[model samples]
Target: MSKLTGTTLAALAVTVLSALPAAAAPEHHGDDGLNWSACQGQVDPRQQCASVTVPLDYNDPDGQQITLAISRIPAAESGLRHGVLLTVPGGPGGSGLNLPSSAAKRLPPSVRDRFDLVGFDPRGAGRSTPVSCGLDHADLAMVNLRPWPAADGSIDGNIATERRIAETCARNGGPVLRSISSANEARDIDRIRQALGERRLSAWATSYGTYPGAVYATMFPRHTDRIVLDSNDDPDPSRVGRGWLAAFDQGAEDRFPDFAKWASAPDNPDRVADTPEQVRPLFLDLAARLDHSPLPWPGANPAELNGNVLRETMLESLYADARFPDLARLMLAGLGRRPLPAPVLPPEQALQNTTAVSVATLCNDVSWPSDPTGYAEDVAADRAAHPLTAGLPVNVMPCAFWPFKPAEPPVRVTDRGPANVLLAQNLRDPATPYRGALKLRAAFGDRARMVTFDSGGHDAYLANGNACGDAAVTDFLVTGRRPAEDVFCPAD
Candidate 1:
């Protein structure tokens, strides 16, 4: 997701149905200064909230401190508690303080009984000491966040926009902003671990969260108990966040067919075409028409639905099958078959915070090419190669003009850790495609095992109803039992 995952990050998880008995779990263990109190918002009653203080800059451990908002639901049967099961939400921006309640609902009660479900607002995110770039409201648009190239594939606009955004962030974002990075997030996870009084912690991380999850596993090998990375990202230390953005090209190609198949079903009220083969060309034609003549869409951020907006919608819709109808509705409205759906927008404050962290993480993770000419060429090439994404995946981002360099090199995930990692991946994920997961798998080498699912969308284990994938990951988390070899889970 580059945490480009919009506001739907929380919905990116599958259900669990593990047949393993609770006997394989570990003994109960936990303690901390964390005081149990009901969360203030709409979270479940079982969830208790607390705060953990850590140095804003790890290098200066005793310097200035910041508070991280954390939450958790105790194991249903504390007698069976195995340890903490930390939930790492996607987005450098997504808030996880409220996620424990929701995640507990998705996890099998047997697993829940053996582990305390924990979540946190990563530094510079929600309820933690937050950071904002004071960006203009218009900058919060999905098309801008995704860095879609112009219809002609010119990146002049992208370069200028990125420069402006970078300048704005540097002007208002302070030292705390500079402290946010994947390495530091890994360090912060360790802090969370110590605060929980757990010698080892299991983790379930998806989308952008998988990067930090892997980093934590690599950096704190002895402290990690079990890790389940769903919808993974490329562990390419060289390109870093830039590689994640570029992945959308292949990701869309991998995922669009599922949407096509769904949209072309004869019984579908939102059928866009009679055959899957026709769906792609029809979509391309519709997007091309919109590129020239955008339809007025009242109340949307830009106040109009243009080709790029539709394309952004397509990328989001492909993250899950449930979102397929959103793209279908937009396509139908673009063709004048129906009125446009009401505009959906994240709350303004949340958008501002998320956009800031996303930009900071991507820019702070690595350096990006500053030359517009190079980006333009790349965009044009990508557009020709992957028409569905229209070169947006390779377009320049705010990182191109960021003022600061990475504080530390991106963490290289090595194959030196314990064999406690289980990866669940959908072959056709649009955000973190299966190809990227393959890279992560290679990086972990003998330290990990993978369960591939013949499914589409971002989340796999619980999302596609793939019982095989779900059981594999669940068994690992619950029983610490993984397949002796890499496994394949056919779609249900």
Candidate 2:
């Protein structure tokens, strides 16, 4: 059950407003307490912006406040409008401020016509009163951001990095940083719903967003109208982020073959091998070669092309099939067959904020074992079982040294919620694997039904262009209907 407090209610009531231009505030809408304004930058003209203030600490609601930036596109047909359909973004740090515009372009007209698409940058992200741990440039690299063990499988270096990161976050992240958690984010969502005067909210939540969406459903079942959890996460309250991280092992194993098939196609320009069977060994050999003889790559973080760098690139490329060529090209470069691509580094502040929010949420959401020995044992076992990920998934993260214990236990997603959720998943999602999606399905039990696509990739909505999965989800959102049981969408 949700552990709401009197202070939480007070925090929801505090109105710390956004500082948008005076010309942009919503005019002539007396019903909306929000002063909607034209969003800045090259955003869709239809997207209007606003902000809400929620307590920095729900337990001490009146003590401090933070703003949550929001955006929306009103229903095209107001006469037939049902209610607000919120879009919950992934990353735990990803901004949802532009979700309305994107969803407007993708969702079927029937669904779009019936509701206002709502989106928000969760507390401590994007324009929502952001926070940062102030990480150094060296630690901002993708290879370093993810905990990759040393070449010899010794976690000594990883331990030092985690400890340093944890110390940095503790020293720099203020109250809002410590307050970043799924539970608090859900509360912030509820505050948004209340501010909109909507009795209930329908949501299309993807990736890491699925966790808080499930938590919201569990916490306030009646407040949820309809929910679509896409690219689902395991709702295991016991392990939380640890389990999500560890799933990367199986996730990589599950998705690599798809990339291999694409890379090894006979006519493919980026072919790394003549046969799919040879692609795996070729990759392993290339990574091993890089590990032994690292190359000095200018402009790349750590300024080197090493085994972990290739592995990190591979992990990132597996997110979408369109990115397969990038990984294949990198493999060719590692084999002295091509040149290295230019790196794209995010601004220092953005990277810092993203890292802080992601790490803070993970560490604050649940407790991870502090002992390095346990992690070492798990890493060794995972490396043996799933060599593709090299036990990186089971490795220790900054969470191991996080200063604060969870404010409360991670919310247990139970079968207690209303039967309003429909989950859409890709069978071979590299980040949230099919098995993890099943676990989420099992946790929701009769409260939810799932549509699994026999496809490989991270996202499974309009992204994959799979008609079956998209149609099922659209039908559910357009009409309050779902398949009575779990269904499979065959590969197209």
Candidate 3:
């Protein structure tokens, strides 16, 4: 899922009779007394905001209450108004509070004018009754959040780190933390639809949001209209979040070539190597050296650049082709070479919320392999196969040591939904690779037609800059016209 830094880049199991009406009933807003004014400040003047209170635990609707921050930008041209179009932001942790504005900008004017653009911060994120694991600043760093093995592929440090983080969250995170699974998020989305009084919602869900979107369509088929899943993740129920965590290895391998080419281009101002082939080894050696001796990075959260820290930054930078320079500059700086200073990290509160929600959703979505030996072997094998990432993708995370089991099973995505879904993917997305997307596509089966872009980056619609891919998606969102079959958009 795309973090808040922006530019770059970029599940469920249950049916419970919460306050929400049955899936077969036409959606209607009851006397929930939702006040659109509460959503102010986060919404544009053209958009109205509302707070929909949902049960923190769907199984016990009357037990405790949680609010979902929801906003809607009504059709700009009322004469052509069609229906509501929801923009589901990525990130099992990413907040969709600001997505209506961002997505409205990317949409074609015709589509933008016809459909009301909606966005919401999923439970445990942003203004929607946020959850916090109360992790210290140092523990919230991306390097710490994403497990990375030691320089020698030893799992000792990683295992200890996972245990510590897990212990912290388990102690600090309240019952809300246990409710932050993908299945719950999907259920919350359906509840939002009911609150909006919409029989069906046209949606554009990206990254991790794709999983919940798929689940929503499966659980409530008739409620989806013109669904668009961008930068999709694999819907392997058996693996769930573990599968996504492991996919980074393949994703990095798929996307590194793009970075290599950019970094080695002779004419580029930030070129780091003489040729693409040299970029990989140069990066590996630099990371290894940093692993042994980290440099002091004053402004960074952890206040230093270790090998794993650099590796984490590399993974984030690869999300967007435009961010390659950020990684290259960091690498150059660590190599006893002068480069630009690193960007400032978000405020501590922001980081805490983002990190907390990310971990809660990921760890709560599925049970991870608890066997330390399994992680050790996988990390070692991954290190050998994809050295650029240095086995971090397969390394142990807090999920491996999480104290609580998933409250519910993962939703099995199947071909039981309306055939209104269209999936768009980049062939080389560093975050959600094509190989994983194939699983999601297969889960949807005859219900979806995929438009694969032969491009590089995390996002695939307007963000990818592929005219072929963009046109296909835009047409579908606007006119409901889908390709007769799966299609590929060649590199431009």
Candidate 4:
């Protein structure tokens, strides 16, 4: 949430009202020109908020404008300052205005002394002049956001749901919604650099942010300093988000064993099975039972715990080992061994806003096939092959019914950039599996050095408790150096 006080809001209004004359691409400016203001809901009092105005559409720079909300925690030591180190978070919709606080606490003091930690809310998210499609509360549920086919693998319902979301967004979302894409995000980041009066920037980006971070590195190679991309997405220009979604099938398969092992452990209070092998069958049986008769979950967004809902919970719980209990407890409830847990959800407005941005960025990035027949066949085939995810990865989405074609081709990350790039990955990341991370590493060619941490769940670097992996990345960020070859850290 933005920490904008009334005075800060007025300052933002004044800043936007007195818009700077739209310039050429960000390269044209080296002037410091940010309007710093009051940012609310900040975890670190030292973090300050500011706004940077950029062209709403990069193509027509002189046309209209939009404000991007950014935050920064100044370098702790003035003499050692190297410049801005931008932090990019995941989600085409992930809010980054407070990311400086999140990143600062985890970084080493050596890094803290060298750069001002900077973060921003992308154009269509958080306080960056947010855009919303006013979607129905029911449509905002995770089970619905990613297409989860019917019990028999039919996509008839997916097609309709996707079409309705697309149509509603088209009618209600204005120019801003149509403008969200990775290419534009790259452009926005460049503008922020110019606004900060910095000649170059180092960046630490994770998950979806890595796409734009890579694009920024590719598009403005000379201006990028040190670059760190963690838990990366496959840079498939043609497929984009489609390929990312598909990875969930393989990712789920790779990460489930860890959960199974934990769930059957004698010390675990939430153990759901007597043995690791039995856990899979138990989960599949419980899900199938829920499909036949959904448990009445009173306060949940959808008001029921169906098979799809269980699958959605499983997908989220696989993100980190710490979240393993969420899935275990849900399994216990499904088996009537314990009561159902209360639904934990974000604020309705935040969900609505982020969902709108997510759909827009995805649909506007690339085209999706509109053929319902083809989607149904793919779903049926995927279900038979990967029952854990039940074809949710290959299923259709709102992009199938998107109202506009992509404004420009997706940015193709290449090997031509500087060798300052460092790629980090967890061996068993459920959202971004090793296979996909490899594709991204290969795309960067000799320009990057990869550090693979043999572990489960998503995120690497300061996230998982792998001191070896964290030291390698921290060493690189602090001294502008990387391992001579692709390094691997054996399981801890």
Candidate 5:
């Protein structure tokens, strides 16, 4: 399917229905009570945290168990409370522990009043007894973390790195790491619902969270209430993460114009070019020059302005409009127009855990073909077609060298689920582009309605998305209202 759609790149990468079907409802985990208490740190007065134990492998329900860290802020109006609205974070590895507090602030009063905002650090993340592959510091660098072939497109180094990382993960990432996957996440969510004693759950899922959310809806259709899948991702079960990595090629093309326009705007103090048209060429030329003659960047982690670092910066900066200046400043530094800013990196342990969980999820959720020659061919073709990404999108990741086959085939999303899902996506999301979101929308069929915003960036909800898109989602969550058909929110 990916080969045909030309969107598969490699492993680098809900509705209320109480009435419809009881058998499809979330599995009944016996009444295990949640003992919510004040969360650690300077949390909002209302924020509370609790932990739930779930099987390390659902297949062996009576086997070893792992704990999930959960947080919540009770609904503003208890009398009007509908149920739990889980805030599913991005990064198959992101911690959702703080999401409820932040999300509660963005949600409209009506929505906030009716739902207990909930968040959780998915198993193996954050406060949930984290696991790590204990990767080397150099290996943790962004350029190395994301597969970028040699300037000439030789993937020998990337292939080697993939093997080493995969082996390291297998050696160090215990059963907890092996347990991290989309299927398990959905199961964990069901456990959360059962613990919460809510037969149906409403969710606001973002980025990669959209995948598990969709999977949960597919696997347990009647278990969901009002579902809002934000910053949607492609739900193609076969390729899974591989297709997401491939979408980066088109995603970069779609999003770069926004950065270019911002960089060259007349009023912009850090203008990279006089006009938007010049910005693209200027960036390409700069990247090429750096590829050959790199610049010294002392404060930066790798301490150099190489082509891959610049490309990584571009990818990171495209996540939000406010981040455009970060890319511009880096570009300026590379051009010798300014000094490089100090790069702020997460703690080493944090990076290791995140990388481990992320790679594990992508690789474990589905299998990536282990053929290096096939990747070589794909990389060459992708390079010719989308030089901005320089074949990085289609390049191999640790998944290629993954030691284990998928425990189960990826979940195939279909229209058999409840028709309560509302998808809101940015037309030009760099991480998850419109084309991929369209695939997810199509998979949902009449079961879902997509509200696309004529915007550029990764997330499309309250952040990055305009008022139109925000209103559409807010309406769905607060009032169970969706447009008669899919709607497009014009750029603001």
Candidate 6:
């Protein structure tokens, strides 16, 4: 749900450390260990970790306190230092803590040596005072947590599921849940910029982070430096989070071709069909069969491989090219051509944090239609139009039943910011999809010029490896030069 793809999740995890409480304001124990030491291990050596205290809620700046875990990779050469560059990770749940180092490696030498890359775990995520609904392990599973309806298109099960999830989160999530909106995250980012002693900060924000970044640029226009928003989401304020959830239908449709081609390739070990076109119907048939009769998946949270669960996994796997095989293998297993073991899920702690933050941000961003009838109507219409998604995108979520209303209205992304923003998007992103990116682009208007990549899966920039698209982004980041007009990079 949300932009909580695995890459986004992993990035958020590293940043999660930034949200942790500060060690008793360290004694003047010296610049001995303070000199920008190399970060240890997989956590970027270029990045130096630190903490900054921000209000739990920005509206009440003098209220309760929370600490944000912040990291910085200084400009390589002081003589070339230009300004600070902030890396905003995706997932309202995702963390940006280690992004400074991660993003530093992606920058061209020109940009890397000119700016200190900064990253932080937003409040209610990762290292920042983490929030959990204390949900049971089963409830934390992706399929269940996302509120996918029963196989036969029944809203009854979904409604019940939403109520249970919403109630549990309300009871156990504490006050932190109330403060987990994207608006709050944007305010927190501004606070981090102030803490960094910067007048303006260049930023690279992706997926869900794009919305907050755009909001930040709008809220504090004078404080924004060059900005890059990758894998952008629809910035429709009225339907903010709902638009993202609804977008999965289009996203899955956009990305299925990549999976189809892979599954149909003659050389592939898990080839499931003779042609790309055949792959879709074959998958649909398999899911429908499983819907009526689920296969026992011992040790799995749901205890069975139901149709909706399989579909959900398929959607998740489509986020990256590396995950294609997982979906193919499952397809083979479901076809009884090559039985395989069940997949291992993430640790309980990780799942809880992910679910908690995802739900909180989505529900707190805007009000979801509470009527079961409304969801039923939308699901029916969506099912007919996009069967691959199985009406899941339009179905009810915990937000529909959430007891708490959003404290603030969703921030509308506008053209009121500096014209320093650039957006990079994959044409076939399963999570953020191109159609939605177009909406965000339209919202930003002249404020952003997008570089659309002819590629499949989610995320763009360094992770996607499309040289044309990557070069466009790198050029913008380094030179603060965006294309005078929108550009498209054909698939290589």
TM-score of 1: 0.95
Task: Report the C-alpha lDDT of model 2 over 1-492, residue by residue, as the tens digit.
Answer: 000000010112222222222112122223768989999777779899999989888778797888999999998897778788899988868778998988898888888888889999988889999999988888877766788888777788889888998999999998889888888888899999888878778899988888888888777676778889999888778887778887888888999999989998989999999888999989888887888899888988879899999888888889899999989998998888989888667788877877888888888888889999999998888878887788788888888898898887767676775677899999999998899899989988888899998888887888888899889888888777778788899988
Tens digits of per-residue lDDT for model 3, 361-452? 77777778899999899888998988887887777888878888877667787776566789999999987889988988998888889999
Clashes of 5: 2
- Tens digit per residue, CA lDDT, model 6, 294-378: 8888887787878887898799889998988888888788878887565687788866887788888888878888889999999
Candidate 6 stretches greater than 4 Å from native: 1-41
Best by TM-score: 1
TM-scores, all models, native as reference: 0.95, 0.93, 0.92, 0.93, 0.94, 0.91
- How much lDDT does each candidate structure score? 0.83, 0.82, 0.79, 0.83, 0.82, 0.78
Least well predicted 10-residue stretch by lDDT in candidate 5:
1-10
What are the runs in model 2 whose C-alpha is more than 4 Å off?
1-30
Cα error, residue 333 of model 4, in Å, equals 0.5
lDDT of candidate 1 vs native?
0.83
Which stretches in model 3 have alpha-carbon errors above 4 Å? 1-33, 38-43
Worst 10 residues of 4 by lDDT: 3-12
lDDT of 2 at 166: 90
Q: Between the candidate structures 4 and 6, which one is better when assessed by TM-score?
A: 4
Residue range 383-492, candidate 5, lDDT tens digits: 89988888898888888888877777777777776678899899888888899899999988888999999998877888863889888888877767667899988978
Query: For residue 469, what is the lDDT in candidate 6?
Result: 92
Candidate 4 per-residue C-alpha lDDT over 1-492 given as tens digits, one digit per residue, 9 for 90 to 100: 110000000000011111111111123233366766667984688898989999998879989999999999989997777778899878878899998998888998988998889999998899998999998988887878888888877888888888999998988889999888888888899999888987778899988888888888778776777889998888888788888888889999999999999999999999999899999999998998899899999999789889999998898889899999999999999889999999988898998888888888888888888887888888888899999999998888888899799887776676775678899999998888899889989988888899999999888888888889999998887777778899999877
RMSD, model 6, all Cα superposed?
6.9
For each of the candidates, give the backbone clash count. 4, 2, 4, 3, 2, 10
Over all chains combined, what TM-score does candidate 5 have? 0.94
